[model samples]
Target chain A: MKILVCLGNVPDTTTKIRFDGEMKNLATEGVQWVINPWDELALTRALEIKEGSGGKIEKVSVVNVGKADAEPTIRKALAIGADDAYRIDADPSDAYFIAAQIAEVVKNNNFEIIFAGKESSDFNGSAVGSMLAEFLDIPSVSAVSAFDFPDGKVVLKRDIDGGKETIGIDTPFVTIVQKGISINPRIPAMRGIMMARTKPINVSQPVAVDTLVEYETFELPEAKAECKMVDPENTDALVDLLHNEAKVI
Target chain B: MDFELTEEQLMMKQAARDFAERELLPDVIERDAEARFPVRQVKMLAELGFFGISVDPQYGGSGMDALSYVLALEEIAKIDSATAVILAVHNSLVAYGIETYGNEDQKQKFLPELASGNKIGAFLLSEPEAGSDATSQKTTAEDKGDYYLLNGTKNWITSADNAGIYLVIAQTDPDKKHKGINAFIVDRHSEGISLGPHEEKMGMRSSDTHSVMFTDVKVPKENRIGEDGFGFKFAMKLLDGGRIGIAAQAIGIAGGAFDRAVQYSKERKAFGTEIANHQAVAFKLADMAVKLENGRNLVYKCATLKDQKKDFSTLSAMAKQYCADSAMEITTEAVQIHGGYGYVKEYHVERLMREAKVTQIYEGTSEIQKIVISRSLLKD
Candidate 1:
């Protein structure tokens, strides 16, 4: 079985985010890019599934819909044990466009399974996996927190409103994985990094798709107010502040 | 002239950092307090190919450069010096010594297991009387044609109980003194070999340190690292490389302490504002950062020199001395920044301070390093 993982790059969670002068784009200066955390979990789970398959799963490939600048992030996935990578040379304008690019590869490759993060941390669009499934005309499972492969079928567990729900699907499926699928994402060892340098990363031209969304402006979240310390001795005062000034009891 | 780490090196550093934070940091304080060896974590590191960071790929190693090894070591040491020292000894001292000096047969026999960490390795050079002056002869290896009868006691040996193989330095000829010393690869499970109870330490408590005794244990002739008289030179050469590892460890410890102090300064309030806003606390952070940068530069320079196979003894000694001193001073200041909380174990700085002290004392003491540096300069 051949598996494909869709990788996305985002600023590290701890990076100090800033907006450009026009407030329409992220300030990239000094920003450290990482494999989107959710996508990393997805890639990790795919590798884990391959390992557990006992020779049934033959290959794991990662694809990214971005420019050459994103190759490092793609290489990171390769270092984490992906067999190879596909770079779709295009600006990742929107989920639909990105999904279309992936679908083009899937049509040619005939991959049995495709995995993607439930949402990219940058845009939080939560749209690509399902859209890719729709474009490819295959089953798509979202918010997959756990999975297993038994007798070549996909058994996935996902979180519902109050609990989890399990579903079994046939081959040729798309899964948008989240946390809890894998205990932790594997860090690429030094050996892996060395090998990744020589690993095949096939770059291909993007299959053009009409984008339906456009960014208007970017805004930073409002800064939080300084904390107000409450005196333990004045219970009434604390209660009054909570009820009136803070307006919470 | 390029100072930036290569992409591969950065990835290796990130991998080590991630592993250290996730696997080693969780129970580190508790482990230190309980003096428990992090066996599971060590195995994890081995699985990640850390045991053979600089070993050749054919020898089951990652085949990385020395700078990469230093980067990884620094990241690991930043979180837990105990675990870092274990890795350092295995990679820098034991496996490196064997790969550099051992014959092809010895390399084939030991490098694979050592690199894979199936058999952990330790360097046994220091003794009760042979700490600073490593040439003092007490351990003896009686040449017996087919094998040698080894008898000695090694003190303050790292990973003593856990190591499966030991690179033991012993005297083959009592009359030759330092020239008489021979390096031997002795299996820890050899007959007549015994271990003393673990030593309770001030810092790096989780790292197992013990006394190893060899009472007439027979070591195969093939296990001798080099020629009979080559032991002293072998030990010295390996120690020069070992200094780079220790220096990296020192930088890591100092970096860790500085990071914590910076975080604390930001969160701590004094005079109705964050302590970081105050000049006194801010200047301390500045000083710590400058020292850390200098120490890191020295460490990497030594590592690069070693990787290039140049004569780096003086540089290694200088790097080790400066970095270790920086670690001690920085950690002490970190505790001071934390105030009373730093004095206690809950805050973690006190433990870092304790762990930093040994770096100044072990491998080669700061005083010994100075001697090496001065001697080199004078000779020039």
Candidate 2:
């Protein structure tokens, strides 16, 4: 089965972010890039299926929609046991545009399954995979808790707001895996990293279509208010503060 | 340049960690307090294919890399150093010795049983007179045609009484000096072979230590490893690998102590805040983590190098010295972090502290390691 996993390269959470007031871009001084946590789970699951089935994986390709900056994350995705990778060279600005780019490449691939994270941490939109599925006109199970291919059928359990629903789809399907699915995706060992260096990475220039959604100047949230402490000795004042000011009573 | 571990190595790490947390940790303190030999834990280790981790699959053992063996040892030792030694001695010192230096017939004769964990093995090197100066050993093996009559007393032998086989190094020709020593494989059932009373140790009491005696014990000529006079060199070579195992063991102990310290510091309250809020306690933890991570990286590098047949003597010595020292510091700090509770036997950190002290002394002392480093530098 041909499995395509969408991996994103983003600054790790511990990365220090600096914004230049002069230019409208975040400074990339000492940034470390890692595979998106959700994408990691999806890749690991795909690798598991590839190993367990004893069937030849046509390609464990990582499909990314970003510029050359995203290649390292693609490389790391390869390092984490993906067979190969595909990077669509276009800075992903909007969810729909990115989805359209993915659908363009995947339309002719005849891929059995396309796996992706439920949401990218940087955007937190949780819309890309669903949009990609819509663009490709394939059944997609988003926010999947578990995925299993038992008896030649793809089985997926997706968590909704209230409960989980188990859905079995045919061979060709799309799954947007959520975080905390499998054991935290393993850091590719030194050997896997070295081996990844020699593996094939297909890079293509896919210009994203113009979109309505555009980024304006980014702004920070308002500062928090100062905390007020109640005097324990003054019962009347504490009661008055609780009822009128703090509103706890 | 290939620095990655195989899938088997990854599995070994998980297995050792799982075994340590589930089987070893629960009774580790009680075992240490009572100076108990964790026979059950030893059996469990054997069941997990730990006793012969580096042995070939053809020999009924897990055909794992040297790094995998060390990684597993580090995890096990983190929970219980005593149980870890049982694994180290059996695999590194004894089984590894035979596998590397023994003839094809010898390998077929003994390795399968030892590798299968069906029979335990121990290496006898340190005599009462010999500790670090192993050449000073007084044990003798006189050739008697078909068999050699062995007479020696090996002190501080781990798994001495229970081991089915003992790989003994003895003076075959006293006049030839260090060259006179020869390696012999002696079965425990051999006549006049007896185990002295188990010694009461400060820590790692859960691993059995005793003096093994050889009085007119006859081992066949076929049992001798390699040629005569090659024993000391073989022993030292075996020890190079053994040092890596001890390094891993040290990392495990340090990792365990540090984990407990971190957990306690986060929970224990003092002066209206958790002890972790205090920079003194917090810095201690941070230092411990730093030392552990660095030491672990070195040990793993050394182990991986050894597996790849790369030049690893310097790395092994560095790892052994750094990890052993780190373990001592970390476990000591772990006790201090526990404050009053750490002084008592009820807390495991106290036991860990005692266990950490020996790692620096054995498998070549930290001082000896410095000497090795200096010697290598001089040669270079």
Candidate 3:
């Protein structure tokens, strides 16, 4: 079985975001790029599953729909033990566009399993995985928190309303993973980083696809209120402020 | 000259930062308080190939450039100074010395194990009577035809008990003064070797520092590094590279403190405003940022020069000297910025302040660095 994971290139989570003068596009200057945190976790889990498969899983690969600037992020995934990677040479314009480009790669290669994060940390669209599955006419499991392939049987557990649900599925499917997919994203090992420089990243031009969504502008969230500290000796003053100003009482 | 780090270097830096923040930061304070060695963290670093960042892949090393080594060491130092020193000593001093100067046989025998971190390595040069002077002959390796009988007492040795291999400097022919010194690679478990109890240190307490004693230990003829009487020169040459690693570590310590100072100033309030608004505290933060940046550039320049195979000795001394002083100043100011909180251990600035003091004293003292720099300038 061959596994393919879809990665989303995003800004480092600590980056201070800014919009251009028109507020329609992000200011690209001085922005450090990284793999979306969720996608990285999915890739980690995929590598873990492959490592434990005892040669049952043949290879694990990654695909990203991005421009040339995304190559470094793709190489990082390869460095984290992805057998190979595919870079669709196009801007990730929208969810459908990304899904369409990935669908082409899926159709060309016979992949037994596909993994995508529940949502990209950048746009948080949460649309790509199910859309890609729909494009390929395959079943997709969403919100997968725990996954295991034991003795050739696929087992998945997801958190429901105050409970957990387990499901068993077959291959040729997609899983939209959330947290608990893996504990932490793996830091690329030195040997892996050295070898990643030689790993082949197949670059293919994206097929034509129509734009499905557009944005006009962006707005920054309001600044947070300053924390007010009350003296430890004055509980009555704290209660008075809570009742009069905060109105929590 | 391009000042930017390559994309690959940035990746290595990020990888190190991520690993240190996740694995080392949480328990660093606890480990320091208890003066416990970070054995688990060291094992994990070896698995990640951090222990041999600059060695060749053929020698079971990471095959990375000096800049990568600097970046990673700096990141690790920011979280745990003791662990970072262990890596600095092992890579820049022990493994790098063997790879650079040892014969093919020595390299084949030791590089794979030391660079892979399967066997820890220690450099033994400072005896009870010799430190910055470095030439006093207290330890002797009596030449015995086919082998040498070594007897020495080395003080303040890092990893003295835990190391599996030792690079020991001893006087082979006292008639020649410093020229008579020779370096040997010896098995730590060889007959007649013992260690004193760990030193109770004020800073970097998490690393094990002990006095090592060798009595009539037999070392094969092949274990000697370089030609006879090359030990003093070999040690000096290797200390040049070692200084670069220590400089980077010093920058890490200062940068770490600078970061905390900035954050603390912004969050801590005084007179109904963030302490950062007050000129007294704000100036300290500003000075810290400047010093950290200055030290960082010097360290990076030294790393780049070393990478390019240029003569980096003078600059290495300058870098080490400047960074150590800067780290001491920065950590002290960080404690000032934290006010009462900095006096305690939990805020980490106190620990950082203590850790920063050793950077000024170890490998080569700030005074020794000045001497080296002045001598290079006065060469006529």
Candidate 4:
């Protein structure tokens, strides 16, 4: 059995975001790219499963819907213990577009289980995993935290309304994993990093997919104003200010 | 020519950053306060193959280039200088020395354990009498045909309490003086070995530092590195590489402090705006930044020279000298920028500043480095 994790190439969390001249796209001048955090966790869980499978699980591959600039991020997945990698050479347009693109390649492969992070860290669009499932006409379980494969039987602990609900699922399904899937994402060892150099990232031309959403213009969030600390004896002034400035009193 | 890190090097840098931020940063203050060794973190580093970052894979090492080691060491030092020094002594001094000079039996016996982190390694050269003047050796390793009976007291040894293997330098024949020096790989658990209590240090307190005492310790002939009288030259060569690690560590310490200061300045309000808006603080930041960059470039050049199998001894001395001095300066200014907050332990700049002091004094003093560079210059 093979597992496929959907990888996303996103900027490092510490990057100071800046927009391009058009105000519709991020400036890529000094961005350090990395694998999306949640996606990395998903990959880690998959690798752990493969390591413990004892020949039951053959390979854990990764597929990324990104452009050439995302190669390093994709290779990071390979270094993190993904058996093989594929990059659909296209700018990740949107959640639906990315889902549709990934489905096309996955349909041709022998991937029994597919995993995707609930959302990419760059754009918190909690839609890709389900969209991919719909695109492939397969069932998917969302909000999964724990996954176990015992004696060829798949089990999952999914987050419910107030607690976790244990679930038993079969193969040929998509799993949208959230936190608690793994404690920490695996850091690539020196051996893995060395081997990653020759591990090929099989790049293929992306099939035509329609974008559902387009940004008109990008704007920075408003800078928060300093809070005015009110003295204990100034309740009346505070009330007056609240009534006039906040207009919520 | 170019300043681009390879894929492996970038991964190493990122892994080091993650490990430092996740494992070392949280309890670093508490560790510093308690003067505790980072036992758990050291194990994690060993598991990550950092202990053998530059050793050959055949000997169970990571077979990485010098740049990768520096990138990782810099990150580690940025978070915990104590832990970084432990790694420095192991990789650059002990493991590197053994791999470069050891025979097949020594490599097969010692390298695997050292690389695996199962057995920690320490370099014992500095005695109570000899500090900067390494030629003066009072310890004796009396030749006894099959083995040498060692008797010495090595002071200021990092990881002395935790190390399982010792790279001991001692005088084999007093008649030959410095030329009679020999290096041996002595098992630290030997019957005659003892250690002094851990030192109460001003900075880098988390690493276990103790003076090692050896009384009639037996080391077989196979454990000696190279031919007789090769010990001094071996120690000198290994010190060159060790300087590279320390230089990176110094830069990292400075960088760590500088980072905290920059963040604090931007948030710290003075008259009506952030302290960063003040020209005095801003100029200090500029100077610190330039020094850090210059030091980093010099260190990287040395690492690159080493990777290319070129002679890096003189430049490494310069790197160690410049980086250690600037680290002391930058850390002091970082604390100054943090004002009252920096004086405390939780703010971390205080700890970084304190930790930066030893970089100038250890491995080779700044004055010793100047002597090396001057000699190379005169010769050139």
Candidate 5:
């Protein structure tokens, strides 16, 4: 069985977010990019499945719809034990475009199982995985918190309204992974990093897709107000301030 | 002229940083307080191919360059200097010595286990009488028919309690003085081999440091590292490389302390504003940053020279001396910047300060490094 993991490059969560030119684009000045945390988990889960399967899972490949700069992040995934990688050279403009490109790769590769993060940390769209599934016309499971393979069948557990519901899916499926799918993402070892340099990372042209949404403007959240100090001797004044000014009980 | 690390080197640094932050940092303070050796973490490091960072791949190593080794080691040392020392001793001193000087059979027999982390290796050169003057050796290896009988005591030995193999320097011909010394690889479990209790160190407490004693210990003739009377040169060559590792460790300690100082200065309020706003504290941060950068440059230069197979003996000495002194000064100031909080163990700067002092004293004292440097410079 061949598994394909879709990786999204996102700014490190700790990076100082900044915008340039009237918020038209994110400033690329001093930001560091990393593999999206959720997708890293997805990749880890794919590796786990490959390891747990007794010679059943043959190859685990990673696919990315990104430009040349994202190759480092893609190389990182390969270092974490991906067998091969496919780079669809294009700007990941929107969820639809990325999903279409990924779907094309999936169609060409005929991967038995596809894995992706539920959302990218920067955009948090939560749409690419399911959209890719729609484009491929295959079953897709979103928000998968747990997964297992028993008797050559894929079993997944997802959070429903209040509790989790388990579902079994056939092969040729896609999964939008969330937290708890894997405990922690694997850090690439030095040996693995050395080996990844020689591994193949095939680049392909992006498939054209119509984008349906575009951002008009971006704004930062309003700043918070400073806390007001109350006089300890005047209980009545504090009570008045809470009831009238602060509007607290 | 380019100083940028390669992609593979960057990945190595990132991997070490991730492992150090997630695994080594969590229980570091507790381990320091308890003087506990991080057995599980070392095993994890071994599994990650850290034990063989610069060893050849044919010997089960990662086949990384010297700069890569130092880069990864700096990350590990930033969080836990004790663990970093263990890796440094194994890679720069023991495994490196064997790989460079040992025969094919010896390499095939030991490198695989040592690089794979299945067995830990320790370098035994220091003795009670010989600290900086390493040639004055009290250890003796009497030649026998098929084996040598070893008798000596090595103090200040890192990983002494847990090591599976020991590369020991012992005197074979007393009349030859330094030339009489021969290096032997001895099994740690050999009969008559004993270990003293772990030393109660002021810092780097998590590393198992002990006095190793050998009484009539038998070593196979095939385990000799190189030609007869080549132990002194072997020890010196290994120390040269070991200095680079120590320099990287010192830089990491200073960097860690400097980071804490910066973060603390930003959060700490004094005189109705953050302490970082004060010129006094800000200047200290600047000085620390300069020293850290200088030390890092020296270390990287030495590592690069070694990778290029250049004669870097003088540069390695200079790097070790300057970096170690910088670590000591930077960490001390870091504690001063923290005022009372820096003296406490919970803040972590105090431990860094304590750990920094050893870098100046070990591998070769600062004075010894100066001696080496001056001797090389004045040689006609």
Candidate 6:
């Protein structure tokens, strides 16, 4: 069995940001890069399955859609235990374009399963996995909390509003993972890092896909007002303030 | 030029840090004071793959590299140095030596158990008479046909009482000084082997350190490591790698001290302002930060060099020396930064200060490292 994991390269959680006047993108100086936290669960679950299933997995591949600069993140995934890798040489403009590129790759690979994060930390759109599944014409289950592979089928419990739903699916499918899927991803040792350097990472320019959406401008949310305390002695003043000034009681 | 860590390395680092914080930190002070070795903690380490960080996966080990080993050790040391030392000797000195030099049959028998943490391992190198000059070992191993009769005294051995296996170094040929030395694997259950009472220690008291008496003990010839008479060279080679573990320990001590100082400096007030506002306190902190960053860089470089199988003897020694001294210096300064509180056991710095002193003394002394460095340069 072969598994493909999709990873998102994003700014570290503690990164300090600033905008250069011209480039319109956030400045990159002093920024740390990390694998999206949710994606870690996907990769870790894949590794666990490979181990628990008695090395039944023939290959573990990671596909990333980004510019050439994203190679390090791809390399990081490889070191984390992916057997082989692919990089679609394009800056993902939105979820649809990213999904289409991944689907293009999936059409030829015949991978038994595809795993991805439920949402990218930066975008929080939670759309790529479902979009990729739709484009590939395969079934997809999102926000999976647990998974098991038994006799060529996957059993899973997916998260829902205030509850969960258990489902089972056969091979050639996609799963969008959420947090708490597995223990935090294991770090590649120094030796694993060295070996990852030698592994092959195939890079190709992704064929452009037409899109209906485009960014107009980025805007900031309205700032919050300072809190005011109610005076204990003046009940009538507090009532008037709540009814008029604050417009709430 | 490629300094970025692989994803797996990142994962291991996170796991070790999380484990150290969750499992080791809460018990450190109590264990150190009571001179207790938490057996459960050791077993937990094994369960989590700490024992087999550098061992091959085929032997039920983690099949991790030396860099991984040091990184995990550093994280554990940050919580408890005693636990870190036990792990270092077990992984670097004992397990690594056996895996590298032992025959295939020996590897199959010993590596699996050791790797799985089912059995603990110890290395016996120091004798009462030979420490800095380790080649002057007085222990002797006589050829008794199929078995070697080992008779010797080894002191200051970590995990001596509880370890199931010991990698002992003894002079096999009485006539040939250092060249006559040989290494052997001895089981603690052997008829003539017994452990001495635990030595009372100034620091790292939670680790069990004791002496061993080998009275006409018999070891199978197959247990010998590498070729006969190669023991002296092998011991040096093993220690060169072990120095990296020491460096990690040193980093841990310094890190513990640095963390306390950073927190206290931010919160403690003196003369109506945070003491951190004082230039005197601030300068001292700056120096500690500089030393710690430099020491970390040196140690990381050494670990990386080791993974490439490069000749990094000098770098390893330098990292050990610099980091150990830095730990001692930084911890002392950390105590000074705390003033009256630093002298009290209630503060963690006092304990960390005591622990920092040992890193300079063990593995290889700071003076011995200078010799290795000078010798390497002179030859070059």
Please state every model's RMSD to the true fold in angstroms.
1.2, 6.9, 1.8, 1.6, 1.6, 5.1
In candidate 4, stretches whose alpha carbon ends up further than 4 angstroms from where it belongs are A210-214, A236-249
lDDT of 6 at B201: 91
lDDT of 2 by residue, A167-198 (tens): 88886667889855677574453334445667
Per-residue C-alpha lDDT of model 5 across residues A66-139, encoded as one tens digit per residue = 89999999999999999999999998988999999999888888898999898999988999999999999999
Classify candidate 2 by CAPRI docking class.
incorrect
TM-scores of the models, in the given order? 0.98, 0.67, 0.97, 0.97, 0.97, 0.79
lDDT of each: 0.92, 0.82, 0.91, 0.92, 0.93, 0.86
lDDT of 1 by residue, A128-220 (tens): 999999999999988899989977678999999999999988888898888798888899977899999798989999876776898899889
Candidate 1 lDDT score at position A243: 96
Query: Per-residue lDDT of B81-198 in model 2, one digit per residue for the tens?
Result: 9988888989998899998889999998899889867788888999889988888869999989898999979988888877898999999999999999998898988889888998
Under CAPRI classification, how is model 3 graded? Answer: medium
Model 3 agreement with the true structure over B1-380: per-residue lDDT tens digits: 78999877888898888888999899999999888988898898899898778889988898999998999989988888888888898999999999999999999999998978888889999989999888996899999999999998999998887788899999999999999999999999999999999999998888889999999999999999999999999999999999999999988988888888888889887898899999999888888888888898999999998899999999999999999999999999999899899999888999989999999999899999999999999999
* Candidate 5 chain A worst ten-residue window by lDDT: A218-227
lDDT by residue (tens digit), candidate 6, B47-152: 7778888888888787776777777888888778999999999998888998888889889989988987788999899999999899899999999999999998
Write the number of the candidate with greater lDDT, choosing between 1 and 2.
1
The true-versus-predicted C-alpha distance at residue A248 of model 1, in Å, is: 4.5
Docking class for model 5 is high
Q: Lowest lDDT 10-mer window, candidate 4 chain A?
A: A189-198
- Report how closely model 5 matches the true complex, as a DockQ value: 0.84
lDDT of 4 by residue, A100-204 (tens): 988987898868899999898888898999999999989999999998998877899999999999999988999999999999999887777777867878889
Model 5's A-chain: what TM-score? Answer: 0.92
**DockQ for every prediction shown:** 0.83, 0.04, 0.73, 0.72, 0.84, 0.12
Q: RMSD of model 2, in Å?
A: 6.9
